[model samples]
Every structure is written in structure tokens, then in C-alpha cells.
Target chain A: MKARSFRVLTSLLATLTALGAAAQEEGVLDSAVVRNRLYRPAGHPELSLSVGLPVQTHLTAHYFFDVGLAYNLFDTLAVEARAGYAASRHTGLARSISESFLDRQDKKITDELEDLWQMNFHGVAGVRWAPVYGKLSLVSDIPAHFQAYLWAGGGVGSFKRKSVIQCSHVVDRTAGVCDDRTSLDDRGTAREDFWVHETRVAPVVSGALGFRFFILDKHGVKLEVRDWIFRDSYRVNLLRDDWEAGRETGEKAPSPGLTHLVQFDLGYTFSF
Target chain B: MRTFPRLALLFTALPALALAQVSSGEQPVPAPGPESAIPPEPVSASPQPEPPRAPRERPPPVTPAIQHAPVRAIEASAPAPDAPVAMPTPAPPPASADDTPDLSSEGPRTTDASQQRLVNGAPLYDPNVNVHIVQKKRFADEGHHEVVLYPAVVQLNGKYTNHVGTALHYVYHLQENFGVQLAGQYNWYSDESHFNLELIDKVREQAQAASSLLLQWGVQAGVEVTPLYGKFAFLNNSLAQFSVVLSGGAGLGATRHLIRPAVANEVDGQTFQVPARYGDTGTKFLGSVGGGFRLQFGESYSIRLEVRDLLYTARVDKVDGCSLSDFEAMETARAGNQPFSDLKLSGGCKVEKFDGVDPKTKKNYREDIILGRDLVAEPSSDVLNNVSFYAGFSILF
Candidate 1:
């Protein structure tokens, strides 16, 4: 492990050195390596258009659709907005194990699952900046197909996630689903309907390097993958407390699962 | 093989047998755990050699007499509160029974009518330590510091755990408890299950039972004797607790998938075990703040309620499982190893430790094969944005 780590470190250092050399050849100074890059002054394409799919690591979504545009008036900065749609689902389980009402006393429980699904839509807008370009003079010819841009911008994005969960019982002897709602927190209690949702400003701070695949008819397309740190919250059901109460014999129906959301997000950029 | 059938028969006939045991005049005593419930493997003083440690001969029949005479129980450890139950119920009583045990079977203990009627005689808590199992829900995550606890009011706590699977936890409290909690909490969420699994995607029913247990303990430096309170009106003698848990814990999570290893073909006849990549485990961060209320019950047992918020990092892992979603994308197999078989971790476990890869073949493991999409991968509701209060009885010696 130690040797492998050493090799990886050395290789990374060499990569950094190569990048520095590439920049030096362009006459870009050392201090401005990250900031100085070329960009064309903006003539906001009369109408900016974009369409892309959402990408997430775990949460399932039916599909995600994104549409956005940018109007760059100056070579240094641009304004942009994007709207997205995603599908999400909520799933839960009610666990109960059956034993011989005979000599065996302990029963190992397995969670019985019920799932819920829903969709959400969100949007964002921000001012993008290219600090190095539009300010410095370049003696060498700017590359026609490439521009390394450093953009720092903040925008608001939100999503609405929802779901519905149904409970079923498992008979130990049969080990099959039974009409036994008793496995649920409310078991035989009257069933109820509820809703949970949340909205928060998702951060769009990012840095990118892209090559213009093609620009024509006052239109241009670029492919770039960027990571944007973000935050959001959602709700979940109240089954765990109910299970605990079940173990305790007479414990009351716990407050239905409290609903809260985890906060974080990452974004990729595809320009058109 | 015959024994297994007989065992199955025996299991089916258990309830009837119990009824017979209760009604029979000679009262055959059956030890709950194992035969060792009796005592004196070698008796010291007896002229006629006695059958030592016989279940029927032993005393304290209703409860295991290991410690405080257990209150009567019916199930494994439930309090059978009814008259007949006080004698028949046998749960939660043996939590503290491991003291100087007199495991002698030929003793005075028997299920007498008087013992069953004696309700108020048992101690507040059960004593058979081995018999009692407790699983406490911990909101170990203290939430996001950027939103909640900041510099002035530092929130520090830790947890550690050890279990058959991935139930290990440990934390260090650096200063929250007066510089006591140097804590690190990890909620590892990876890809295993997905909620949006399509119907044609139904998998053979099985248990992908992965569990997590947390432990939090560390140097508690604040006024050791200070009392905290629960916010509820009914709470009494609330304890202001702030401690860091020395963290050392591991998790072994097992998920079983009903596999259908099929081969898919390309434009040409060359086939491969459907090459697919599984997604992430949607684990999240859980944070909580609450205290126990030692309700003025017979014992110092309390009602514990907590207000907590659970946060999940935006998952970068894809949520993929065997589903018709990609059914159209499958190809025919060329035949070497099973396509899904590639997911098997190789190098015997220690060496097969690659994240999301089939360590054995070093191939892209498909989630659909290992963890079907219908499998709930996101933190299950059991550990979701959870918030609940437990009003159970607890005792501190």
C-alpha cells in the first residue's frame, strides 16, 4: 500500500508539472495559471437553448430534463439559468418474525418493504466569470477550439420529492404475505394520509475547462463535466419507532415517522 | 434428513404441546435456552445420587432465578401481565441473571399458584443478561454544523459499534462535554437496492439484511453530576449529557439477491454475462439532541424522546438494479464465467476489497444482478430522516 501510494503521488506531481509547462509555453504567468484563460466577448445568442438529463448517484428518478441558456455581454462574464426535472421514490419496510408459539422464544425479524415514488422539478440562475480572460493580452494565437474558463457563481435550485407506502404482513409458518396489518405500526389502527416536502437554495459554485466542439449560425456547443457542491432536504416514514414499540409490548403508536431531508448535491455541465 | 422432517413436524405441533405441558399433572419443566439452565453438575452433599440439574426438579420455575426473581413472562422475554401470564411469560426478566448462578435443577423452585399471583414481588428490571437483547435507535449524527451548532455552542459526540454484520461504531468526544468529544461519525451509503424497480423486475424474495449498530462512549469532562431535562412536560430528572465516543467499529452487511444469470448477445454471436454496473448505497447522516426522562416509576426507568434531523449527502452513486429498465440493453453471452458471476469478490475476501467491482473478475458488477432495483437502496425508512420518541422502561443500577 505504501509503495502504491508513493507511485500515485509521484505521478500526480509529474502531471501538475506538465500542466505548468503547457501554461508557460502560452506565456501565461505562474500566479495566473488557474485564472488566466481565453474567452470571446459575449454577443448573447439571441436565444440560448439547452436540454440534458439529470444524473444522481443513488436516489432513483423516472427521468431528468434540463433546459438552460446564457447571455454573455462581455468577454469576462455571462449570465445563465437552468431548469431540471427528476423522478424520486420513497421505500419503507415493516419487519416481524414468526416463531413456534411453542418452545422457541426468540424470533429473528426481517423488514417487509413497501415503496413510494414521485417526481420533482428545480431551476437555477447565476453570473459566470472568467477572471483571466478579457483582462490580459495574449501574444500567441488563442486556440480556436479551446478555452479554459474559471467560473464562480451561486444560484437557487429546489426539488419536490414525494411517495406512498403500503404495508403487508408476513406469516412465519407460511413465510408469505398475509392480511396481517398487525405487522405495521398502526396494525389495526385507522389508516391515514399525509404529505411531506422541502425546498432550499442549491449551490452552483463550479470550475470548468471545455472545448467548443462546433460554433456556427451564432450557436456553439461544448461538453464539460463539472462537480457542484449542493444541499437539499426530503422526508421519510415513521416505521422504526413503531417496531421498537412493538418489542416493548404496550408502547403507544410512536409519532408517525418524523420526516427530514439530507442536504447535498453535485452537478455536471453540458453546454449548447 | 429424517430428523429435519421430524423437526418440522415438531415445530408445527409446538403450540399444542405447550398446552399439554401446562395441563399435565406431573408438570414437565422445560428449560428455555438450553439444558444448562439447571445447576450442580457435581453435587456436593447427597447420599443417594440425585439426577442433578433436572429441569423439573429446579425451582423458580416462572422466571430464571439468576438474579432478581424475574417477573413472569410468556414469550422469549415479554411481560405476560395477565394472571396466567405472570407464570407463563418469560421475557425481559433474565437481562441481569448472570450473577452467582445456582444452576441446580433439583431445587425448591416450581410453578406454584402462589408464585404466579405474586405480582409486586419482582424487581423493576429483568436479570437474565443473556436472555435480554436491546437494540437502541441512535441519532448519532449531530446535523450540519454550518446550519445548526456553530462555534459558541459546540456540539460534539461520537459512536462505535460491533455486530455480526456492519454494526460497528465508535467516536471520540473532544470538548463538547467540556472538551470531551473528538468525534467522527460515518454513515456509509452504497448501492444495493432501488425503490423505482419496475414490475417485470420482481426478484425472488430474500433478505438483504444489512444492519448497523452504533456505540458512543468517551471521556465526559463536564460537571459529571449535572442533570439534563427532556422538553416534554411529563419528564422528570432530565440529564444534560454531552459525551464523545471513542470510535472503533466495523460493518459486515450481507445482501442476498435471487440471481438469474443469463447471457446476452451482440450483433455477432459473441455473448457475455450481461455486463452491467450496480449503483451506490444511499446511506445518510443522522443527528439528534434529546435527553431521557427518568419517569417516577417504581424503578429509575425513564421515557426517552429526542428531536433529531437526519441529513443525506447528495448521492453521486447511480441507483441501478436488475430491472426491465435495462432489459432491452442486455446481450447474449459468449460463455466463460456467468456474467453476474463476475461480481464475486476474489482473492478470498481480504484481497477482493474493491469498491463496486466484482473483485474476482475485476469486472463492472451490475446492480440489477446483485441488488435488484426494487431493493430499497436509499437509507430505508428505518434509518431515513427519522424522528421518534421511545417511552420504554429502563433501569440503572
Candidate 2:
């Protein structure tokens, strides 16, 4: 009778073991949406070169040329350092206002315009967090793998301000000319202007939303919309007579606000 | 002591295990291969399987008939039940499943082929066949309606004028890649930007009339086409689908121009702040072209980020139905303390708009006659492009 009980117990144990194996297989059937990533950047170092074009121009426009070095800590995160020089200039609207303001003697007492600061040389270190990875079917046979990422960082930059309202030495008042040109009609002939200029070093913050498209194995193409933000500092409550006569006229504004330089950047990268 | 407790627990669960087996059907489950996990393909019985093609060749378009057909052996890892795996499916060089021939009675597929396979499912005789990557679509968007609400549409290139508003759009999917859309936008806050105001305040200069024209509202009918779609994994945990959408439309928009900025009014020895004034510039023809990404979440919800350029023809010949001649007469009449009621003006002119004095600020509207005249003196015209960023969500039904 004891032998019969042992055989029944053994059969029950074997049945449970089989059921457990089937359950484990069922769990494996629930596969990940994307089973494997095509490109992984972890533990790799990369070098990049980029050019930035102004998205919109108000008083000023900036064209940035930068080179970056980055190290990927993980598949989704990286640290990077970028250094660049921006070739900056005043927009046509700013030039129009500056030339016309030279002749406007009726407006004698007014505050200087805000957001005249322009960035030149800058360097920043930032972390890039790429939380999204995907692939695009470019054509019948080609699949493009890419990552969407956000980057943010802060650094110091050399900035300069050229006053549109204040010309230190006016050449002609009635003709609305502030520079030394051979003829009044052609302002482009002039090499320089007499606009009051100031230069300083200040902190700048930059943020971007971008995509990195992986090519083959080590190469990538990047496109992004980046914004460089900095605090604005300008003089307020100025006298036209004081500035034209080459005399410092106004006091610094208490709260001048912030300036945003938005640009669209296209870049290329190579990984090591 | 631990052994005794474990034995008691196993005995206690024995009845529940037996009940579960009884509830579930008695059919012995197949040893789970990836093919066993797939539900039965709704294809015809005894269908002949196509020979495998090269991996790089374009797959046949997926029509309704082909979509219902059994998943091909090349597309899935499993060989047909009848075709033995040891013998390579003969005919063409080994290729991805995308190279499959169109066997459906209907015509070729218009949309893109299925996504490339990422997971290795079944073992193959040729190791290279294992690299063949293509899988059928898991979701379809044909014949559905989507209503999108853009809570914020902020102007990106606000050089002279600033605009912020909301927009609502309805889209009907005619096909997987094509759709028809009706879009409407209303700008509740439209005004001269601070940059323009600063130029006026300090340099005594401002943007031309046409350059600073503001859009109050617009309505457009357009078509949207999605050229590309893909899947993305977020933080290695969540997955979402996205499509690159491009759209174009032509329509009409209402516009206005700033007549006067806010100023302090002194009436009877007391200073009162008077608000800025805007004059209606009537409706103008508008056109739009835009492109962006639509990130879809599940079946009925999505998030869209787009940049649209709202182009409008701006010709400022009249303001508030008052032409240059009308403004000249109003200014002449105001110079001499004369009532505008007696002046002869166009029948459509709203002379009353410039005749009254504000009761709160005690500011006279007649003082704005010269400013109104200045706007029409040159009759500036421009094709203004107001590029803006739109962030919104959608509900698909």
C-alpha cells in the first residue's frame, strides 16, 4: 500500500514540473517592441563639426561655426564640449534705424534700445540625453537609424554691443549718415561706423532639440534647433547730444531682460 | 522544519492546479516555437508559398487580399507546414522578406512595405537567410478621423509683429499616407512686438504698414501627406510610432494694424493711462505650407509638433474703411474744431469710429486722424510670411 502511494506522488510532481516549463515559455513569447537596437553609442568617443544659421533676425544675426568632442557614457547619455566662433552682424532693420536716428534731432531724451548684445567666441560643456531611438525606411532597401536627443549647458562668451541710437561722431545730420562714405547714397562703401560700442564677457546658456542619424557604423548626420540665451545689458535714459559728442551719457538699466539667439544647425559626426 | 512547510504548501496548491488545467482546454499545447505563438493566419487553405527572393529587393505592396494571406515563410521565421525546412525554398537568391512577389488578386500596394524584422525568430538552413528583415504592419490608419487641438501656436519669426493663438484642425484619412484637413486659427493676442515698440520709442522709426500687419483669424482647407513613418523606443522602455507629415493650403485671413500705442492722457489736470488702439484692415488671401512630426500614442491619441508659415497678402490702402482721402478730410476737419458728421465721406466709411472721446481715459479719438493718414500715404504692400511653432494633441476616432 505504501509503494502505491509513492508512485502517485511521483506522478503528480512530474506533472507540476511540466506545467511550470510551459508557463516559462509563455512569458518569453511577450517580446519587446524593438528586440534589438541597430546602433549603440555606449563607451565610444566622437568628434563633430557643425554650422548654425540664424532662424530669425531682429536687431542682430549670428552665424555659428563649432567643433565638438563627446564621450558616450551609455547608450542613452553622453557628455560633450563644444567651442565655436560666431560671426555676428546687425540686421538691415537695425541699420535702417541707426541711419535714420542720426537725423532725428526731435527725439532728444530716450532710453537706449534693448537686446543689442552680440556673441562672438564661446565654449560650453553639456550633457546630451537621447531617450529615443528609431529607424526610418528611407527606400525599399535602406533603413535609417536615428536618435532624438536634448542638450543643455552653460558657459561664458565674449559679447559686444553696438548702439543704434547713439553715434559717437556723426558725419552728416540732415542726410542721416553716421559713417564716412564717399557718397551719401552708397553706405556700403564706408569701412567703419561711429556707433557707440561696448564689449564685455558674460555667461550664456544653450539648449537644443536635435536628431542624430547614424550612417553605416561610425558616421552620423545631425540636425537641430538651438537657442543661445544671455542676459541683456544696455544703458537707459540718454541724451542725444551727449552721445554724438563722444561723451558717455546714460546709466545702465536696472533690469534689461534677456536676449535669445535662435539658430538651425546642421552637423556631421564620426565615432571612434 | 523548512522542508515540512514546503511539502505542506505544495499539497495545498494541488487542487487549484488541477482546476486550472480543467478550465483551460485539454488540447496539449504545442512546444512553443515563435510560430506556435502566432495566431492562425487567416489565409486560404493549401495556398502555394512563393520562392524566397533577395533580401535587398523591394517587397510587394500590401493590399487587402495579400494582407489577409498567410504570413510568408520569408517574412516569418517558420517554413510552410508542408515545405520541409532542410530543403531551401528554391527559385531566387536569399533576400529579405521585402522581396516577396505580389500574389494578391488586387493590384500592387501603394504604401510602403512592412517594417524590417529586428528579432530573430526561427532557425534557417542558410545563416544569411536569418538576416532577412521584414515584418507585417501591426497598426493601420485607413478611413479614420482625427481632431487636433493646438493649445499654443507661438510665432517663431516675430521680427515686427508678435502673435500667439490657438488652432483646431480636423483630418480625414483617405489612405494610409494621404489625408484631407480643415484647419482654423484665432489669434487672441496679436500686437506690435517689443522690438518694434523700442524702435518707435527710442529711434523714432517703425516697421512699414504692410510689414507689421497682424493676423486676427484664418480658415484653410488643405491636404496632408505622410511620406515616412517609423517606430521609436523611449529610454529603452517605452515604444511609440511617428510620422513625418507635410501639408499645404490656401485660404483667407482677417488682419489689423496698430494705429496708436498706449499713452498717458492728461485731462482736466489729471493723468489717465489710455490703452493702445488697433484699426481693422479687412480680410486678405492667405496660404500656408508646413511640415512636422506626429508622435502617435496608442490608437486614439497623438502629439504633434509643427512649424507652419502663414503667408498673407498685405496691402494697407484703407484702415477701418477710411481711405487716404477720408483721413485727409478728417484731419482737416479736426484742425478746425469741426464736427465729422457734416463731412462728406465714402458710404462705407465708419466715420463714427474716429468721432467719439473715451469716457474712461478722456482721450479724443479725433487726435488719431494724422496717424491714420500716415499709414495710407505710402500704401505699402508685402507678402508677409508669419512662421510659427505649433504644439498640440489629437483624438482619433
Q: DockQ (Cα-based) per candidate?
A: 0.01, 0.12
Model 1 docking category: incorrect
Per-model TM-score of chain B: 0.23, 0.69
Q: List model 2 lDDT by residue over A1-272, tens digit each.
A: 01111222232333323222222222111123232455668888999999999877777889999999999998789999999999999988888888778888899988988777889999999999887776565543355778888788889899998988898898998787888888899987888988888999999888777889988778899998777878889898899889988999989999876677877899999988
User: Which pairs clash inside model 2?
Assistant: B54-B95, B55-B95, B55-B96, B59-B98, B117-B133, B117-B134
For residues A181-226, write the lDDT of model 1, one tens digit per residue: 4454453442432222224444433333322322322344544332
**Model 2: CAPRI class:** incorrect
Off by over 4 Å in 1: A1-22, A25-39, A43-46, A54-56, A62-64, A84-119, A130-144, A163-210, A226-229, A234-272, B1-397
Q: iRMS of each prediction in angstroms?
A: 41.4, 23.7
Query: Against the true structure, whose DockQ is highest?
Result: 2
Those runs of model 2 whose alpha carbons end farther than 4 Å from true positions after fitting are A1-31, B1-137, B264-266, B269-273
lDDT of 1 by residue, B255-318 (tens): 2222223335342354445533323333334343333222211112121211222222222222
Compute the interface RMSD for candidate 2.
Answer: 23.7
- What's every prediction's RMSD, in angstroms? 35.4, 17.8
Per residue, candidate 2 scores C-alpha lDDT tens digits across B1-397 of 1133224334433432443343232222122112111222122221122233323343444333222222323343212333221221112221211212322211131231221112233222221232223222233456889999876676656678777778999999888778999999998778887667777777878889999999999999999987776656555434444678899998999999999988999988999999989999999999999998776544576666677999999999999999999999999999998999999998877898888898999999998888888999999999999987666767889
